[model samples]
Target chain A: MRYELYYWPEIPGRGEFIRLALEAGGADYIDVGNRSEEQGWGIAAIETFLGGEVTDFPPFAPPFLKAGELVISHVANILQYLGPRLGLWPGDEANRLWAHGLQLTIADFTAEAHDLHHPLGPGLYYEDQQEEAARRARQFISERLPKFLGYFERVLIDNPAGERHLVGETLTTVDLSLFHVVEGLRYALPNAMAEAEQEAPRVIALHDRVRDIPRIAEYLASDRRQPFSEEGLFRHYPELDSDG
Target chain B: MRYELYYWPEIPGRGEFIRLALEAGGADYIDVGNRSEEQGWGIAAIETFLGGEVTDFPPFAPPFLKAGELVISHVANILQYLGPRLGLWPGDEANRLWAHGLQLTIADFTAEAHDLHHPLGPGLYYEDQQEEAARRARQFISERLPKFLGYFERVLIDNPAGERHLVGETLTTVDLSLFHVVEGLRYALPNAMAEAEQEAPRVIALHDRVRDIPRIAEYLASDRRQPFSEEGLFRHYPELDSDG
Candidate 1:
């Protein structure tokens, strides 16, 4: 069965995590929000689910997946549900849970990355909270960034299966999500990541490997892939980035 | 099999969410972090997993549950695993996924609540970022708090099962977690929750219902339950709270 992914059309936000998994898993799915008015699907399609019509299981936010009768929201939840179905999971309950934990960590890291540019919450624009955002970015670059990247680097190094993958001997959605996170960090905070990546060589290698995955490579080069922008989660405002 | 839960011993932070589920589910478990040194457990027990001995499946942070050989991290993941086993879940695939989705939203809400005092991230203290905390608290109380509470309130009212539970006809882990969120809000932002609760009567009623659950009532009165305090997630800082 084909899946319907509902997210904001303009940016490669959290939805991109699921998109990478869908592409890497080689599943048949449509990015609903990206479709034009002629194709009969757009932001309105996403709003319909959030517009109270589907009251029983209303998604609180975008980046929800509609698979048959299932509407899964939250990036980690969607990835966990899609992982096994798309053959992106390790196929064991234990490893699946482990991968989900890593995905959750990545989610937390991504939230922090987003916060670096909007430290006062999304209710206000980044311009309104530039001072606070700059301070947050400094602390984030000096502390949180290293802590999370180092943790993933350790996870990769300590993987009993080997250092190549995060969970098992094969690829899982966690790897895909991590790859996006690394790309996001590099794109959003080039100077900081250039320094940070030095200590996380293994994570960088895994990111490179994920990029080389034929399906992900094609999707990255295709029109379906949206570019990162200030409107998305990992925004690059040079003022909120540092190399310390 | 008895489950072993590992988290920070003092505060009823994220770990309390998992604790409530274990108690409500009537599962036999050990709160490893809360145990005494004489009992051969404490913070060190939690550190063991983080200390790198468990190479194959290391948890990024805690409130991790060890059930037999499976180690589940993240409050939602752990509850989702235990919900079916302990009969706290709705016992259907769709409703279970819905419940998990709600739990994930609660997780996001909880993080925001924590951030009200730590808007600069946990690298600094509330005293260090009191001004930013005040700004964040205003946004949280005026905006984020109501958005989340209203969402849950709608979820409760929209439940096809009835206006009782967040997921289905019976109490699920989502209800338990939501109850804690309400309690935390009321404790941390009494002035704000008093006004916000007006718009979320159904959610408030659900919290009351959770409080009356026989198992949960007994647990609340027992020493096993910790009190909300300044050191925990829901710190009662009057300066950072407002009715509007």
Candidate 2:
């Protein structure tokens, strides 16, 4: 089955999370928005996907996945649907729920990271709210980053099987997402995340292991892995980072 | 089976969404955090409930529902789990997914509403970022209010069963959440919502109908229905409500 991902083209943004799993699993999928006009898919094609007569399951926003008749939205929900299909989640119901709980935490962190640059509103330019962004970035760098990372670190340490994965002993989409989140944070808050990593060695180690996976390694080496930039969630604002 | 809900005592906040389904279905449940100290349960009880070391399924935050061995967090996830058990969702898988999609949209709107007041960070006081709050509220009141309400209106109108319910002819949890979202927008953006409602008659009608449900009527009349206030997600800052 072919999976079509619809999201804004230029930035890795939320779409990258979905892209990471699909690429890692070597799934058959197309990045509809990222393709050029010559390939018969672009921003216009993405808009048409959303515009075509709306269904009851219509996505509130992009970063949605369309597989056959099924259209799933919300990053965590989409991943939950894709996890088992791509062999990225354990088959057990309990373990799936545990993985889902972790995914929800990752989603929460992603939203907070986005707010650092656009605290005022997404519709407003980042420059318009740099002052407010600076304030929010401070709280995120100092309090939230440690608290959230510490919570995940404790979860990993508390895993009965070991610190190999977030849920079961096997790799799940939750682990891949954590890897991306840590990567984004490093780019956005290099100094702060560098210090916090000492408190979350398990999380950092899991991230490294995910990168070592052959499929993920190939994807990262290929052009599909979009580079992080100022336009994305984890933008580097010099004022927001500190060694402390 | 009895369900125990753990959330902060006072506000109708996120917990209220869960409360609506339990109340409407006449399910046996306890709002554990709101129980009086004399009754041996209060905020401390809620804290203990949260802090108790548990297995991997533990909720990261409050407003979680404990039913038998399952303890679910994320308001939308909790509602999705309850919707089936409480007869609040269509039994068919497709309809269930559609209902869940609607609930997720409500959750998104709720997050946007909360951000209007705390544009900087939830940890900071609203007074510390009033300027940014004013700017954020403007976008929410003007742009988001119409878009979300308009989407719900379209969903209801497009429902194959009818416009009476969000997903089907039956009253799902999404309907209750939609009612609350409308109530929130009205409280936060009286002028903008008043005007936008002109284009979203179906959404308005659903909100009115949810209020008239017999169990909902009793819940609203009872003290369990907390009034909207400055402390809650929907705040009536006169500066934030405007013709824009």
Top of the candidates by lDDT: 1
Q: Taking the tens digit of each residue's C-alpha lDDT, what string does model 1 give over A181-243? A: 998988899999999999999999999999999999999999989999999999888877784
Interface RMSD of each: 0.9, 1.7
Candidate 2: regions farther than 4 A off: A54-56, B37-40
- DockQ per candidate: 0.84, 0.59
RMSD for all candidates, in order, please.
1.2, 1.9
Docking class of 2: medium
Q: Residue B91 of candidate 1: its Cα lDDT?
A: 82
Task: Quote the lDDT for A86 in model 2.
Answer: 91
Summarize candidate 2's per-residue lDDT along A1-244 as a digit string, tens digits.
Answer: 9999988887788998999899887899999878996887888776665664645566778888888887787788778888888989888766766677678788888999999988877888888888888888888888889988988888787778788998879888999999999999999989999999999999999999999999999998988778899988778888777754
Q: Residue-wise lDDT of candidate 1 within B85-170, one digit each (tens)?
A: 88888888888778888899999999999999999888999999999999999999889998998998888788888999888899
